[model samples]
Target: MANILLVDPDDNAFLALKGFLACGGHRSTSVSNARDAMVFLRENILVDLIFIELKLPDSTGLDFLRTLREDYFFQHVPVVFYASKTTHAEIHEAYGLGVQSFHRKPYLQESIEDEVAKLEGKAWYWSFFEPDDAFCRRTGRSLDERGAALDELEPVIQSAAQAYKNVNIELAEAEKEKILSEISGFRRKVREVAVPGLEEYLSYLASFAKESDWNEFKEFAALMGYYAFLCSYRADIYKLERKAKQASAVLDRLAQNALLRSLPPHEVHALIPHLRDYEIDEGATLFKQGDVGDAMYLIDEGRLGIYVAMEDDSEPKKIGEIGDGDIVGEMALIKNAPRSATIIALKDTRMMRMEKDAFTRATIQSPQMKLAVQALAAQRSMDSIKKRAGEIDISAWSKTASEGVRKMGERIPNGFLRKDEKESEDIKREAESMDHWNKMIDSQTFPVVSDAKLKRDIAALKGCPVVGSAVAAFTLATEGMVTSLHPLMDLAEHDPGLAFQMLQNANALRQAKTKDLESFIDDARLCVNFLGEKRLSVVTKGFPRCCESFMYLNEGANWASHIKFLLATANIARFTCAEMELLNIERAAFLGALLHDIGKLLFLRVQPAGCIPVYLHAQEHNISIRESEILHMGISSRQMAIQFVENKSIPTSCKNVIRWVEEPEKATEDFDLVSVVAIARYMCRLCKVGFSGETTQQDLLPLEHSQLWNSIKDRVLQRFNVGNFEILVRRRLRKF
Candidate 1:
């Protein structure tokens, strides 16, 4: 609240004296003696308070005080003088020289206070107070009016400048904040809009893959990769989608050529993530039984064989065969069923493989494909039957025939003679009353065979005793029967029992017959030859819708499809049973009619879809399981039985009825096979056997003609007996 100055040549003394003056109602300025006080007065011309020393120190304090009134700079300065030891006369002299107060030589405390009080009474003026005479007044005309106008305008200008400066600072800060916010918002949009858009595009790219669209796939992949790189600034959707699509594209292109088309789109996508390609050498086994089957194989190039064991022997059997336009080892994808067959490459091959889950997904989606795959499966089963049938021994057959001939044993029946003339007369009288019962076997329809009985018969032939000449005769007769059925009979080793069984099964399956059995057999032979052709037309024209279902095990599949197929197969087997051990074979045949091609598992290549040209037994064996698994997945164990066993290589539990019928001794144990065959045969008869009334037995015999059932008649009957065949037909008709 107060401004005070302390100046002194003797600084300590000035400070001391200033402290005493500060106690009054005024601030104080101190200066030593007179010279320093004069200089202080020159610079600071006005003071609210002041002190000076009196005596002869560099001009007396009184003269120094007097100098303040003379100079313009110090003319308005305030001052007081004091002497530590002063006479009354000296004080009187200082007061008379314009000092405000006077003190005696021994200044009493009360006197100093009275003097300081006297100075404070005049403290309002910072300029030196000069009694009333020093006050100035302007004399120009109208000066008061001009000064008043200047004062008013100065306040307006200062207010405007201050407001402008404040507004400028606020605007600058607001602009800076706005720019920062806009940048942040732009970045957010880029992530939300731009990044996700790229991902969606990438997803579409993965969907449209095809060999003809190779350029499109590559461009899309490049675009996706670029998107991923651009989105690398963050873990955005575009980057993830790009990577996923790239992997899927690889899977799609590399899959067994036609299989990807059959797979569900989503499953194809899933497999794209894990698909790997491999090149294989000729005659290489890709996998064996008991190996982990986490993935399915697709043959990209070259051929391979699927191999399985024969039921009665330890050697692996070639159940079926494959070439291009086939898929292999797909069962591992849906369930954990073990590999029942081994896939082997017969030539250097390329294969595309997918992980198991991806394969399962593919099957679960496409219904149309599921039905189409049955033909290939049935074809494979037929092939296996042919192959295994070749292994049957003819020696036992000769012995059995010879024994039947010998068993008649010289017990000839001749008309008995009467003991007397009276007996002769009685015989003459009896003859007039006698009536004959005529018994004739009428095969008005195609003759059906018992598969079960034939198997047993062949087994019986394996060890029975026979002369070499009889064996030769039996073998020749069987060959002749096959030759009469079809021309293609020459391409494959003919077994009468095998040929008969195929015809019976087909007849039972279709519930129809050829007007001429021989003509039908010839057609079957021609069809087989056509099937053996290795060309694209076989798949596109011959297989098309029929083979589509074979691709259920790709990565992106129709979801949850495999379960339905498995359930359907199981339902037929279970519901058709009249009793636990007795299934209506005709109804089962109808149920399995669609699945006759299940043996195609044997033909799958270790590569993608292709057939192996090599004759390695192991490769052929695996083809059986691969195809079986594809057609009827629920019978994995049965497929394994067929693959590993040497004889008629079907599982005892599933195919036992055939075993019992083939071998009468096993009848009690294998009643189910008997029952099923019986019912199937009955169903075939109901459909009406296929020969026309105009077709003679010779015309019906196997010929060069191409009728469906003509070629395999002999083989069919050998396996299935006439009795079981009739029973199967009757049983089915009863159901209807």
Candidate 2:
């Protein structure tokens, strides 16, 4: 067994490599950072090989190698730099520092074995000892005999290659038939697996086979056969993952949903694959009243408002609100009729929809499920009739008649009269308040500065050189320049203020615990890994001068709070976008969230006194900063942001995102992205990650159950393997 030292900052990666080495009869000692590796090397002198990651917590692997090479005892030790991706310059530099080999981090057992074999060949002590003849004979051969055997094998290898080519010529037609038959079998499996778009792919491959020449046909057949096998393998993996995910979702639904709870666990598990998951935005219609219901939906999250429209053309009366675990439209499926009420999402909602056919099958298979469905359907039918009867107009009755009816209604104690009266009074108060607030907003004047003036003011302020350099560095990293660390170090050297802010952010977002980073390079590496290239680039570009501007506008504590808020918002936005699968606009979302309050920064820079009055008004009224801005000044912080990026190269869609995040209802396009940013901002405030000078703790534009923790609870459970989001929040808040 070989004695090896493994140095990598990633705990998972280090453990995985260590396990692989153990399986190969090799012993490994691991340290997560350069400082620990140095201590280990000094204490233990019997290591035969060393494997290091390119990026370390305290120093680059290359730097460590240079230091190690200076030590006489370790100069000739075999060192391998195992990394994800390395540039030519980094490779050359590592070589110059006396690295014996550079290996790409392997993801397969065969690749791991190959790396171990290479390490065994380069053991420094092996050369010092002479081989024993008896041992050599037992192992198969001496050096001379091994060389002769290799010489003998070369012709045999060539002969085999020639024979392989001839076999294809001899059995071309038969081989084609065999491949076609196998492909035909695979097509049925593909369909059974239900891989989206695989049918069309197989059809295209079939066409290619028919149009090719003999030699090309053989090649195409081989390619098709391999692809089919690969798809089948992937399908198996996907099936396992899907089954695991659906099992949890199903168990949660069954535990809470009354109708589903009646069914057996095995029956629910069987039904899970047929259920379709959907995410609906607030104010979006699920189905209209009197529409044919093709599916029944179970609410897994958020609230759905059930409304009944009057025949007299009056506003629709909201019958009730149904929340998580409430099943809707089941009656429609059973009766084979229209839906009784319109269901609309009152907030962003998640649901699992089971079609009529699947529901029928489930009911048919489980008599208990059928009985439960019938009982619930009958109960809903009775409730629907009562709700419709209550909606009848009673204004035509005389006062005396109404009083007599009210006395009679009290005797029965239906409870509708008292509830309606309470609701009416609440609605009246809300309407009056809105009217007064609207008048105040209308009376205010929103000053619009010319673009030229805004540009001049922005130029006059000292920019954060570190942030600018990070942006430049991110750009270069994307273009395949030196590691992301190079640009970060350059930026740190240029401006320590920006570097300090970045380091703070890096420490906040780190998922692992290592020694505190001692330099900008180490911090940069951590940031790059945490935020990734795309998000880091977006963040740096969005707030080019945030640190400098914060210092210029606010005092010590306030400036620090503002910086924390920006970084927290940026990280939260990234997490939200990834969880939602919004890949196309992830960068845009990250940038929009980070710079959503840029206009406030600009106001602090150019019109510091103007914001004070607005701040005071917001505090007095218990409103958000945006509302106060609109109430005191006709425009909002969003308007300032619009002007700030008006002349810049930002996408119009991204600009719309920033404009409507505070008021998502007003957004004409990209509403989902805007809502995501809005939710992320709310989360940052809810967690009290930092102070953004917004007075109100509650969201200004509210939706029921729209808080970030509520909306993303299931997602966090699935993605982060955590039961509580507070744990994630506390982990992120460590730097604070």
Candidate 3:
């Protein structure tokens, strides 16, 4: 039960407010005017809460609030002013005068109840005292006078009890009830209630109790009734005070817990009021895989195992482990990513859980700190991997061979420090390296791609480390073709061209003495410089062109037949070319295989912007090129010309290559060229082959024998290194 003081000018408003307070279990006092309120306070001043209306009969409510604030003792007590549609300026002014809150007039009954509850709920240390009223109330009654009134009221109970006993003997129960009801009705109507002068206060008192303990007063039983009401009222008010204190304590505890969870150890110690010790048992599972998780656990003691389910097995595999002084489940908590693994206690563990809300607040306050912690975790993971590595054998012959290479790299001049740095850098570097190697070995590392498409896209491109080596070798082996291009020779004649002439002179002098077949075999450098440029340019661009040709969707079958012809041309070019006799057949075959898609240059270039058109003719110069009679006639003319040249050493004419290009299907799968061609064509559609398309390799190569490795043995080997192929095939076949 709260002790409410309602200060309002309207009589009806005062009565309504007083009645409302009574229903809410408060003993309310009303004051209609500021002057009379000051007088009442001088007489009695124990107000738990004050609700002053903005309007008063005599003066402004704001002025009274200012007066209350000026008095040092009244500053602690909360004051809520009543208003009806107050403007922002008025509200700001009221708060400036030290009012705690405000209540709008004509509010719902529940709203009034909420304001009263707020007052009662507050801790009692800030309530008003006697000095507050004495400062302004001109009545000379001191603090002692108010204290005396309370003391005097305590003794009135015994005298009232004796009068009530006398009344019970004289009056029947029915008449007593009737008299009480009539008195309640009269008091309800006639009460002026506001803080009036002492004379006015006494006048109402006199009317209420005519003759104290008289024969009629005893019969009415008013004395016992009044004493009981005073006793119960004091008891109820005390209970409310106790409940308010308990609520305040709970709020403080919750605030402390929240602070501790959000802050770092040093800062947490400075902020939290107390630390609650917590623990967990061994084999305890904090969270399981696939669970929606929020809180993260901080390990204080004991070990934990982090396990993830294997891709091929139903049971979980132990991927990692952690121990004291570590934090777990944080990744999922921070990113809301799904839980990657399950954490189970390996030993009895003592840990603290920082809830999601606490984590969010902490992150908002210190983003840099979170990143530093992640960096530390990565370092720890690497360290653990190195530790585990020491216990594994990994000693197969192939493994031994790779390790030997690593060892040799270690022994290179100044190599000791490089190896040492790799070994000594924290575990994080090791974990990163492990993840990288695993992906690289599986081909899953580069990006998922079709074998044929990847080969075609990379064919004869010198930028890649592997392809660059092949290009350099080819350039060195084909230096004899430069003499035929008189235009390029004239362009290279002097001054800054001195370097070019010197190189050509050096190669010409070396070729003069290199006459033996074996001597010529070792002399590939001059040959490569002669014609290597044109061949490489064609091969480098083959992948993209092949991809375009294979990507035809509207008339794919016709395009497939066109691809078959290109493969035949590639095979003839590979085996029939004798000028490259010094190099082994295998090297020639690899070059042939890579060049199988060379026709795509002419094919896709003829397409508009090299785009795959709905009708291939949109990009093609002549839509009938695939079926023209000019193709067979041109090939016949070229063969006749080649037959008339007596020196077989003379290179095949451009017309011969073009004639072959015209009738693609007429060329057979003779030699390994056909297989190499099919593979290049396959890579064209499988964009992941890095050829830039949007479908699977299978869509591009639908032939029953689309897997064309056997048909083009020489050309295929030149593009893909044997060592890399072995590694990839072994990895893929592990399941089998």
Candidate 4:
């Protein structure tokens, strides 16, 4: 195994590289920046390989490479540039400086394998799946040892509990004082050590879900049980103190929301007394995964990080952050489930928590509040879940938990883990006994997702039969909350139905001389105000349910995936445009990207069923979907979309992008716009955000190797954070 040194400030890159090394039978130590890398190198003289990013906070990767070359000990050490920010000149300079390889961002398993195998002295031969593999077997034994240690700790915890009981029941003064001392020591142990350790385990297990084998999954479930046992015994540390002084401020903020504004002043005021102010210190965890949802906190001041341990357990991803006037932990209240994500205070924070009982009572008193609360809960759940929904291997976790865990449970003291046993047990048992594996997985995970407030909410959507695309549906379902003009305008250009409806409504209002007509029809942000949520709702809902052409109507996974792809492209387009701003492509790239795949739905709607799985073939053959479209039906999807919008009120720049997106150099008037779209599409493939038919690789070439990236990367690197943009594109993939 190679002793690798990782130099990258980005957590995304660091985790990715660490996982790569761990899986490939290599040892690695990581430092965030160049100085740390150098410092580590000096201390650890036996570093075998180095994976460095080009743009470091303190110094560039090229400078680090030069620094390495300057030293006799470090010179000739195999170095790979694991980054996206590279121009031809940078690459040429890197290789000229004796760099061994350049592995691009968003790497595939094969690429990872290839790079690992290329490590000069590393042992790369290992079976990843087999249970008997050296690493797996070794890790399994270590886990057994860890489990035994937990077993040893159980009796001590039991002794502490008994001591508390003994002191409380009645005891001599000396004995009582001794028991009290034991209780205090136990409190420190559980609060300072047990709680934090258990949390770290849970977070890591959550991220390790996909890679874990049956035994490891069982271990995770057992850990969950231990966590509950610890938390229950240490309840005194978690007891909340309510502050009545912040009631006025809490009431005022609560009144500002749309739901509160609709209620009568008395109804709104009645709910104020139930809110309890909570002060969370900087770095304090307000709540954790698997915690009971007794209350939901509405932020009053300071930032809170929403962390989901999705793909990597070493670091739970900070998916988003919320400040004053935002909600957290509501989904757990709505679904009546344990917390799915952990909320940690980034700074000293003040929040008003509304207990579930009071919230339920308030909603019961006001029917409008119930509907509004459910709607908000559904939106929030869907937003967080959408980012990490399909990725978690819950079925695997369930299957492992159900196997002889009955014996394990019988051994544990009855109250070991209080939650999840009754609710999730049947789902796990049912999953383990299913005949069909795929069906078992879907059903098992359904329970996990059902706790996302979707069981009730998705059922409710059956009543809302709207006629707009997913893009439009997302816009309105999210409360028609438009923060910027471009996201709105970009979304409008993609949904043909939305665009046409807006134009028709604009014309009707214009001819009638109504005040509703905005000066510009293309101003989507202003135009949306006139469109009305009710009207937009009708349009968007109808697209998936009303039309036969809308793909994956009843399939939530497929539906989410398809919509996610377009949104992913839009993200890439934003980056592409931002990068291309030097050459003066404004919002054209974003608008063009929205319309780039406009014909995909048309293909599904108009084409024969036999040939509609163009993406499947496109992926299989490693060819462009457009090429597959042309090969299958003698016409491209983009070409069909171009015809659809030719007579509509579509922007010329967008139309040109549709025309030249696949072949940007062919465009004359809209060269930069077309180029940006082309570049963005290329990125969408590279990042693998959503599964489209497009082959992300340009015929065995990476992004830096792609002709388009090489042509424009010089300018792109100056303005764009390629690593961050890749992160954003993948994040958007999970989001949509």
Candidate number of the best TM-score: 4
List per-candidate RMSD values in Å: 53.2, 27.7, 35.9, 29.4
- Find the number of clashing residue pairs for candidate 1: 122
| lDDT per residue as tens, model 4, 1-736 | 4677778875445444543444344555578888888777655544667788888899899999999898533565678886654798999999999987886554433565576678654321111111223423555543233334444555675554343323322223335345335535544444333344543443444433334333443333433443334433223211211112233345556543434443333345557668787899999999888899999887778899988886557568889898876778888987889998999999999888889999888876654356556656667433322222232233322232233222222222222211121114334433443333245234543222221232233323312122223332344333434333343344455443345445445445554675543233443444555665555555444443223223332211132344455556766777666654533544556556755775654544333231334554454555576676665555666666666556444456766887777777667767767777776677666544454444222332234445766665554446566556545555554443
lDDT string for model 1 (233-298, tens) is 222222333454454445434433443433223333434445577777988888876577777776
Which clashing pairs does model 2 show?
A: none
Candidate 3: C-alpha RMSD to true structure equals 35.9
Q: Against the unseen true structure, what C-alpha lDDT does each candidate score?
A: 0.36, 0.54, 0.40, 0.53
Candidate with the larger lDDT of 1 and 2: 2
Ranking by TM-score: 4, 2, 1, 3
Best by lDDT: 2
Residue-level lDDT tens digits of model 3 in 405-449: 222222111211111111122234335434543454345232222
TM-score of each: 0.21, 0.28, 0.21, 0.33
Please report, as a residue range, the 10-residue window in candidate 2 with the lowest summed lDDT.
Answer: 412-421
Query: Per-residue lDDT of 302-343 in model 2, one digit per residue for the tens?
Result: 999999988996577898999997888888998889998899
